[model samples]
Target: MNRFYDIINKIENNNNEITVSEYFHRCIAQAINENEKELVDWFCKIKNDVEGELVAWAEKHGQKYILGRNRAERKTWGIQVLLGKKIKYKDTVLNIYFPTEFHENSIIVEQCF
Candidate 1:
């Protein structure tokens, strides 16, 4: 099994809900095979505490909108939908929520879609 899958399995087996940060950390630790400190720093820089932001955005935007990154390269790490609501990209009126910003070398956002 791939390392990412392994971390998912472990989390599932634990039967305890974990934060998104925890999940990201576990996946990065297991899969990257690189400098741990660097990877962790990168992860911390880009990952957002999305739950609260999602809720607030949804409430304000009527729960129908797209959430994406402003940076072109980091687009994938941005979410396209939340709670089954399709995010509308390029819609100036629709509100969008992005993950935390990071310095250029600290993190790379993978496209989510």
Candidate 2:
């Protein structure tokens, strides 16, 4: 049986919206951890590079992406994230590091992986 599911579909959960590049990135990380050779081989056949996928995805959302840390996170631990549009709060302004969903008055992270 062809058990391998569509990588893009699997990464984009029902509640969370994910771009193709993000899916591929997470797939690579997971594939490496699991050492899934077949997965990698299949991925190679579909996309020649991740750059094109990223640029296209960014265009779709009308947002830009960067590799380094954001200004707010600069003086801190410098943990990397897929920084989105900047958001303003009642007390302060912060960048939308990632998509989120509301869960009964609580915020749940839409994990990339």
Candidate 3:
């Protein structure tokens, strides 16, 4: 099997969801390796488009959006939220709530999506 197919298959079989940027970067890399300029360009364009949506969503909620660098130096999109901020998470018994207006230091990538 081709190495590119193998990589994609591995991603498909994984249980965890990948961020949009990660997915597109992988596609772009594979296209580059295969010398497919059109494929690479398409992935690059769509990656920007989708990531822009996430940024817009974060902005709409009055949250600060960021592209944070990981250990691998890759950029990941997320929103900054407070630790004691309001969130709607239900436990087995009931839903918990917090102060809607506050500030903290936590990056929530899931919230952006």
Runs with alpha carbons beyond 4 Å of true place in candidate 1? 1-26, 31-35, 49-53, 62-82, 85-113
Candidate 3, residues 1-113, lDDT tens digits: the string is 24333334333312223344565577687778778776567557755765665565546655453222111112222212222112332111111121122423222233323
lDDT of 1 by residue, 8-88 (tens): 343331222233344455656644554555545544444453434544555666644323322111123332222331233
Off by over 4 Å in 3: 1-13, 66-113
> After aligning candidate 1 to the native by TM-score, how far in Å is the CA of 56 from where it should be?
3.8
lDDT of each: 0.36, 0.35, 0.40
Error of 1 at 64 (Å): 12
Residue lDDT tens for model 2, 49-108: 434433444455555552121112211211122343232311111211221233222212
Backbone clash numbers for all candidates listed: 7, 0, 0
Per-residue lDDT, model 2, residue 56, is 49
| RMSD to native, candidate 3 | 14.3
